[model samples]
Target: MSDRKNILFIMCDQLRYDYLSCAGHKTLQTPNIDALAARGVRFSNTYVQSPICGPSRMSFYTGRYVSSHGATGNFVPLRVGEHNIGDHLKPLGMRPVLVGKTHMIADQEGMKRLGIDPTSEIGVHHAQAGFEPYERDDGIHPDLVLKPGVKYNEYLKERGYDGHKNPWHWAANATEGAEAPRSGFFNDVANQPARVTDEESETPYMTRRAMQFLAEDDGETPWLLHLSYIKPHWPYIAPAPYHDMYGPSDVQPVHRSEVECEDPNPLAKLYQERISARTFSNDERREATIPAYMGLIKQIDDQLGILFKFMEERGQLDNTMIVFTSDHGDYFGDHWMGDKDFFHNPAVKVPLIIADPDPAFDATRGTVNDRFVEAIDIVPTFIERAGGTVPEHIIDGRSLMPLLRGEDVAWRDYVISEYDYFMQPFSPKTGRVPLECRTYMIANSEWKYIHAPGYSPMLFDLTNDPDEFVDLGRDPKFEDARKTMHYALADWSLQYRQRETVSEERAGQMVGLEDKFGVLIGYWDENDIEPPAQMPDYASGLENG
Candidate 1:
């Protein structure tokens, strides 16, 4: 086996922080994921920069906040010049490859202006969020005009599935029934097994692709393989045996309260009124949906077992680093909400487990780290581990290598998550203008504060109500706490490092370069600054002229 380091970044869509057995999901036992956690450090309070998929993933890829990247919503293109994990890792001779979803939409306008063809090799990576994709599947094929799942659909057709229509919907996303199978898109039928077999499902298919990529690797170059899985997300359907793994008995009580629904802030009320939220709030819908959700997770765990065993057999595990995390969490009827787009823990906080092959990380193995970490930290961690310097000014997050090694470091006290809901239905319904349809959440271990431009701020005392049943946003009694959070948000916002073109060292070097060019200003005398030796006596030339 080669001594070069490799990183396998496994991301599961909509897998919540508490859904894994190691994370204390009582009924949903994930032995494969649990085994990974046993040999790794599980970050308990990890939060994403955004609760939504696209922005959260952009943050993870770029190591910058959503506002900084300016891709604050789904399908929003990341600006053309933005640096991502691929861009950063390439300089260190590490290749970053993608096998699944990134939720990345290319900045077509920016590319066009720069005269870059979309079909070019560089342009393809740019469009794919800086990844050389082995097989990129976002996994949502609804028979739409522009079908993004062309590769997966073709694979399904090649396997003797649907030939003419969208097999992703019928064979993979629909539930088996006595009559014609029902669409899994409906929560009512989500409990039924998918029409396809487990091996052919989306999870296993992606797993196979990842395995193929690893098997074909030349092994000379260090690589970071992003094995992203788009499951346990929605159209909540799981293939057989896993479909019946857990029933209603495994479903936990929904984390919501009448108090929240009765008197919610405008944003909270807007989310509660969404059709998906209302559907999830119903007992029958949740009962049907959660079982299939758990089943999908179990299927993912099994697939991970297969992938790990393959790596171990190939001796790849000896030098590879494995990271397991989710883009964001699902609300799942929490706080009277269904899908994620808010500040609640269920929607924002995600599970992060890192298993480094180096024996140095064994000290913190199987430990639960309560320190606040964010999605942005992953990029810097990878860069640091690959023997590259972390560009602190360009990347907003600190590397977690120290935390993994159980070293004492100055950790962050608060984490921020942002949401852009301009494209969501609630924005127009609530009469919110596009620019004002943003919300920023700042949270510590005890309190979480959400700031909406036109709406009253939402605050939750996590110390008292970890479930977040009550809102203290409009409460006058907690004025001091609210003020403190506001100040912290302001401090963080003011520190946005937008000047990426100039490094700190380069900026310092720039200080005297202008003076060397004789553009000196406000200098009382030439002696005030030690002129460079190359700089001749310009005064003598002036006098001679």
Candidate 2:
């Protein structure tokens, strides 16, 4: 085996923090994932920078907050010049490869302005979020018109599944129904089994592609493979055995309350009234959809089992640092919300497990860390593990290698998550301006505060009301807590490292360069300053007398 470490960074989409057995989900038995957790550290309070897909994944790719990266919503392009994981890792001679979803939309306008060809290697890397695309699939192909000739659809067609125009929808995202089959897009039939087999589904397909990449790898070169899976997300439908693995009896009790829906913060109320939220709020819909959601997760776990076994057989496990996490969590009707776009734990907190093959991490095996960590942290972690120094001025997150080594470090006390709802209907319906549609959530171990511009802030005392049944944003009793969180948010906003071009070392070196170059702005006489050796004729032109 090569001395250099190979990183296998696995990310699941819309997976809740507590959905795995190791994370305290009683019914969802994710033995493969739990086994990985048993051999690594599992972070209990990991949060994403954003609750939505594109922004959250962008943070993971760039190691910056949503506000800093400026990709705050789905389909929003990440700026062309933003440095991503591949950018940081490539300099260290580590190849960062992607197998599945990134939800990255290319910055075409920025590319045009820069005069870069879209088909060029540099342009392709920028479009794919800095990864060498092995097989890029965003996993949502509703129709050919919306996304014509998706690669997955073509793969399905080659495997003799071309009955429908978009086989991805019919085979993977639809279920048998009374009278006729219905698309899994409707929550009513989500519990039904999908038309395809488990092997042909999205999770297994992505896993196979990842295994193929590993199989073809030259062992001498170090690499980071981002095996991102799009599953347990909406269009909730599972294939065959996985579909019947769970039912209403296996579905966990929904974490919602009448009080949450009765009198909510204006922003929260808007989310509650969303079509997806209202559908999830129905008892029957929850019963129908959650089982399929769990089934999808179960399928992903099984796929991991296969992938891990394959890696072990190849002797790759001994040399690979395996990281398992999600872009963000799903709401699943938690706090009366369906899709993730809020400050609630279910929407933002995600499961993170890192199993480093290095013996340095053996002491912390199977440990549960409660320190607050964010999605942005993964970038620096990969960079450090690849034998590169972490550029703190460029990356917004700290490397977790210290924590992994069982070393005591001063970690951050709070985490921040942002949401920009301007692209959504919330801005138009509420009549709020585009900028006012943004919201920021700051949370410590005990309390969570949400600050929405032009609207009342929302607060939740996690110590007392862990389920977040009541909103304390308007209550006078917790005004001090709210104010403290606001200060924290403000401090974070002011301290953003947006100047990526200048390093702290470089800035410090620049302090005396002008003075050394014989440019003196304040001086009384020639005796007030020492002239440079290169300029012996230099004079201050002023007299001390």
Candidate 3:
């Protein structure tokens, strides 16, 4: 067998860092995820580049920040030419295969302008965010209105389920006997058991399909399989046993202060008044959906157990590296917020565990790294594991290999996160909130700073206010500290984006008929010579090696 390492990159959608037992949640126990952490390294503080889906995952796949890649929101496409994890690893003889959702929209305008066919191999890769899809189910079934009948829908229909009524909802999102025509709202069907069996739900289906892919894999080349799960996100319903596994008592009390609702950041106050948080804040709604959310997580943990056992039995575990993390966390009504957007710990922080099987990392096995890490670092880590050099100009992250190998290394002193709330349909109608669209956060172990355009900045001394309940942006006592953080943000903002740097150089170095610059084609023979319209073809006379 080849000595090349395989990567099982697993990502859970909307999973919070504190939800896992290893991350210090007292109630929720993720044995399978905990097992991975116990066998490897757990990064206690990891932040996503963006708080939302598309931009966050784009940063993850491209190893660049949201500003760098320019996929600033959900449904926004990563630019066609951007190098992603697949683009980087495939050249190293590793197949980057995707088994689940990427949430990447195709750059339709770019493709059309470039005359690229969406049905072609390269076109399909760009459409799926640069990875070849083994199964591309983004998990928002009803949202696939553009293309009727998605793969998951067809899968449900094939199994005698009613696809006419949107079986994805019937089988995965809705509970048994919850009104024949239930609205596709979590508040309507929350905490109920799905009509389908647990094994037939989306979580188990994804797991089984992943295992099937492994069974059929040729195993001739090293591969990076991205097993992305889109559960524990919403619709807050689980199948059969998992649905009934938890209750309202299991739901942790909402973490917030009444004072937080008063004199809040303009955006935070606006978010609290929005439908997302308001809907989740109702006492009954929280009781109904939060438990279901926990159940969904439990189902994921159980499925992970199955996948890990299969890997061990197939002897793939010893040669494979397992990475578990999420794009971002759900607020869960923390700080009077529901969905992820603000810089609160529950919204920005995510769990990251990397289990390297290489003997060099044995010393760091079962260790925890508290230094702040970002989602961008994932691509670089994968490249390093695949024995490839990361493209520094394109990738904006450092490798964790040295830490994994138990070597002391100098790391970044702070981490940054960004969010753009302008696109959200629900805006501040009262006009009390500023029209600021962008929010940037620069944080270290001691202080967290938030800056929004045209609004009062917010600052929290994390050493004292770990939950970030108090904002000191206007406090005179914190003027010096806030100023220091502002400098960090300024430094971070000044870094070069360099999006077209390589493209421009490549264009300049290539001429009409050969790999030669027009000015340099005969520079040695004649200092300044115009190149021929069409260089003489030389391939025909070149001897075969």
Candidate 4:
């Protein structure tokens, strides 16, 4: 009875798609990501084309658009020869097993737009793409984290921290240096049960390495795993019963009313004296503060209830294919924001639960798909469910497996969120942060759109303001729905970044001339992927116009 479905792919870094209680997110418990969204198919308008974190997981594993994988900025690097989805499902025999973190870095200009042969660049960037890294680390950096272990930094040094003031180039502050690293946030081990061996958790070391990789392997073979966590992404540290799980009178505050944020785009201003709401506030700071982000979303919902109770005690929970989402999201204090580079909808609308334990999609079990998917349709929905064939010249994402077989699939009406800062940092010399050509969005099923570069269009009609707190891009009776959504946000930013080739002859004008005329030509020196040793004369003079 092997319908061939093994693919776990759970990710939760900076998780936010309304912190799951089936996404309305009132208090945040996550009951195992709401029981894996009652057995899969959640997508209440998903997103993440790019908000951050390795260019939104590299435009979600090459469904493309980080400006067609130039990875369009953010510490730059990644360019390796395209074909990922674990090099296109390891050629149909399926085995893309990652089991944690797939931010996928690729250098050498992503290996010269992947024609392949900086050697053969496989997995994690195998020594400049020749292929070998099932795991590699090139001086791992994110201001380098993975801290806490002096009995958890001496339990954040008996707690009253003072860690990051004299120039914390971002990240530092969990009461600054130690203590609040929150080791078991004071785990009183009594009537025993909290035990996942809580050593100040990172979702019990990523669900004990995904339950020792789905209980000693055979998670139904045809794999694609991904895992990636760092905790509700922050030094918001949570250890004991999720560092207290919520109190300040059942914490839910921080939706912004004061400390400024009526922002109808006075260029959506920032740096309001370095924002706050530290471990979140508003409900008279009662301290359980959304129970330390719902104890780090129930410590990743108890490592997704230890990988769905080890896939229902290894019967392999009806054939596998989980998905639970998150790559970007976590503003916690909404408007008076704190994290996530901005383009709200609680920071790029996440939470996408997929679950599919098939009987050819058993009535999409427990069903909830409000359609509108996009994370570049998750690598052509894992290369058309591994039987493979999404190769529209390497990918632009498209297969939600025909809306996961409920069929009527039309999709892609709108869903794009992009922002840039080039891995955000540097100001002292005003060195970085340029190329501020930004974009923020939301579309009609009630409108939102934020738009940037000396901002202005802030619209929001999410039907009587679904908590986008009115700005209707500045009313005047919706001035013809703000000039019809400013030419429908310039036709949804030019038909989702339109370009679809034209060339009968305009190759960036004669391959953009090299040192011209007398030409000392310093570059255009094809270092490898050969063929054009000399095709020069189209009426010579290195052809311009």
Candidate 5:
């Protein structure tokens, strides 16, 4: 509302790059999201910093990789002192507000050590990934303990939708069946309507609240709204009309090869055994569940239309910058995998669309960028748009403004994505060694290299095997390519480890500034500083000498 630019960042959970019509899915159509691409820049090769939820979102929020932020898994709290987009934006007088999920875990130990009260204003921001939370709902992880009157649950009660018995769980996730009473049973239910009506569903609720925030905004200062939606992740069910929109016929053929599954990478085979992909191997299960996944995505597209219209009516489109992306991608049985935890494109590659309404970007609008971008780039992008200087040492990402303006600039030739499976309950059960629980992926347009400490590195040649059904890691013909990639990975790791060097140098420069400016702690003026305690004997001795 102030003349300053505003940012509306919309992120969906577990959304794949190829799902949207604009991204070229032969069957599924997302005209609303596609329309955004038609008027903006759609990046084809964008990747997230991690393949899982909490770490991925943390990377996006902080503009730092999982290793830098140290919130490597779900329910792992972000370190309290780490800076985020909110911290960077504050210097520019902008507030980054959250409309939905962040999946941020509070650093209880850090908070206690710092003597910061959990209920205080600053404490809440510190714990919630540095966001001044407008409304925080991590979107009902099936394992979360739900209580009464917590935002969404309260809204359900007020709306007269009693979720069978557990209103919140039943409405958002449960199906009407014998399995309805079982906690987390709906996660495997497919092609069925949720217990709540379409209007009462979680997607619609988040959309409506986001719109309300826009309408209630007084326009006093430029603001950023992280309108994050938690749907299309799991509990593969949608409300009536959306639930039945797609069926078995719409499910894309699984892009997997039997040979790869037969002799998979060590980590890959272990993950396949642990997740729903193992269960969905049955044709009937894949068909039933894939369509439900499509339905959930369709519902999201419809809600985006509503949000876009609201922005248009408010005459905010011309002055606002809209960015749409996802935290990660669902494997959907790709390579015999289900939930994201692998470096496959289906699990790590996500759609990234940026619509800058500023006139300077007119030439690049509607263009597709093949340049490599990662989730860490998001916060820096927003900071640059808000007219704030990005702290290079603190933020590991580069701004996309140069590309948005159609300027020719040197861009990174490769991107990095990693995942840590050590925290999973199944890790110990599988007899996985400590090093085996971690994996790192480095890739470029031509080759992708995956390194797991205890196993042989995996390599995929994108030009030949686009589906990544073959492993060239052990193949002699690709030895040169494999070696080159391994060196790149090593160089990247070393560079990342030095990110703190610049910050330390900057901190060192401030060592004498306090002395130059005169510390007022023990003095009111020059006369007050003339005491024996304040004056050093060396000062006069040096002059006499």
Candidate 6:
């Protein structure tokens, strides 16, 4: 056997769980992810620690909750002295190399790759962190028009394009060819894709880099590489073959109702526009849904094919522990949301496929582990697979090594997912609304217990109401059930989640404090704040006795 095993962590930007072929998807052929899942374990209810990009990515790297990491949103970095998996693996003689997008950090470094000036305020926080982020060469996102498989701009230009244009439109129109030439990704020519490819987009590049690392014997040392992709996420454009991979009618139908506004979460209404790409008629959705969605997934799978083939050819298929997952899930038109950050099924559930490298440990493969798993589990699992140690300080995730070894143990009775409702507070941020009453969910196989601060809570009997159209939390018949799950959310929070404690007087001092420090939004309230107790990390403690 090799002295140590390699870890191939393939992360997609915002892929949902149900989109993969291994998990009951019929129309989309994700042979690559499928092949990996066929040889490993797939979790039916895997979740993201946080729903948004920045916070979720922070949890993966730190293995801590947003409460602990103090990075509850985008635009902030895990504070200095904070431990990260990369920093953790460094001592173990393992180098944690990041090959692609890390939406976790912005600001301090310029967005040189995207060509945005650091001084332009386009980036989130790294620039605020005091590093002169690489200023954009010309100020534009490179991939706007530069997809992998098919070259778009030249094709459009060849077709006699005039200006910029977005090919994706309600009218089935291109944004540029007529008056705009579809507005290249570059303000001038940036967003325009010179090429588009199914697998070529994000997953392929990430896999290629990782495969190169995996194929390298590199003496007796093992490698831990995080292949992060920005695609299958947003600006949802899949390159051809994939772009034309499937018929629109063949796609899975989206969740839409005449009464979308009746959901009453208020959050449901507040973030309506931010979540979905656009409102589509039933007929429009039928024609547009499957083709683009399945095509992107198929593209992601194509890369998986390459990565798996590389592993198999190199004799490392069964010798390496491969973890396949995403930062979070996409809405996919579920609950009228298109992106993530919402706690709906399509937006919250991501695929977690782990393959044990040892034959003796391979029993866990080909089985569905339906436990409530989260992205945080990755680090502990990786640390153990390499025969290294799992650090107590940085990791909140339990190692899957026990499950892999067939130990008779349960992982988590429930999983917690958090979201910030700064956009629409039931009250107001003026110390009047209570920071929009953070929403937390404690979910098990039978139900989902959601606790939103100012608004009435939500409880979905996922077993029965999988669409989550019903509110079981408020139902008197399920009072006991609601209490049971609510307690779980509360109890779990008391155990792991933490946030700043600021009194009214102390809060006033922080009004203009933006001049000095970063913001870490709190998911907890006064009633929720019981501490044994170190104060909030904020200097000059917000709450004075």
State the C-alpha lDDT per candidate: 0.89, 0.88, 0.82, 0.59, 0.83, 0.62
> For residues 349-414, what per-residue lDDT tens digits would candidate 3 score against the true structure?
999999988888899999999887999999999899989876676788888888889888999999
Candidate 3 at 313: error in angstroms? 1.3
Q: What would you estimate as the lDDT of candidate 1?
A: 0.89
List TM-scores for all candidates, in order: 0.96, 0.96, 0.90, 0.31, 0.90, 0.74
Q: Where is model 2 more than 4 Å wrong at Cα?
A: 144-149, 176-181, 531-545
Candidate 6 lDDT by residue in tens digits, 1-545: 66667776777877888888788877777777776777888877788888878778777777777777766666565564456675556567765655665655443332665566655643423332221112111111344553332222333344443233422221112122445334322112212232433333444545565666665656466666666665566544455556566775566777755555565566555556551435333346435544655566777777767767776887876556788898888665666665667687777778888876687666777888877787788778877776777765447788888877667895687787886655433235324343554677678888887787756677888888777777665568999898888788777777633323443456666563632332334625445343332235466654432
* Cα shift from native, residue 467, model 6 (Å): 3.0
Error of 1 at 451 (Å): 0.2
Best by lDDT: 1
TM-score of 3: 0.90
Output the worst ten-in-a-row residue range by lDDT, candidate 4: 165-174
Q: After superposition, how far is residue 133 of candidate 1 from its true place, in Å?
A: 0.8
lDDT of 5: 0.83
User: Residues 90-137, candidate 4, lDDT per residue (tens digit)?
Assistant: 677676655445555557554456554554434344322222233222
Q: List candidate 6 stretches off by more than 4 Å.
A: 106-176, 179-203, 211-217, 256-263, 273-286, 423-434, 496-545
The regions of model 4 sitting more than 4 angstroms off are: 1-10, 13-91, 96-202, 209-211, 214-223, 228-283, 294-328, 336-346, 349-374, 377-472, 475-545
Which of the two candidates, 1 or 3, achieves a greater lDDT against the reference? 1
Q: How accurate locally is residue 362 in candidate 1, as Cα lDDT from 0 to 100?
A: 79
502: Cα error in model 1, Å: 1.0
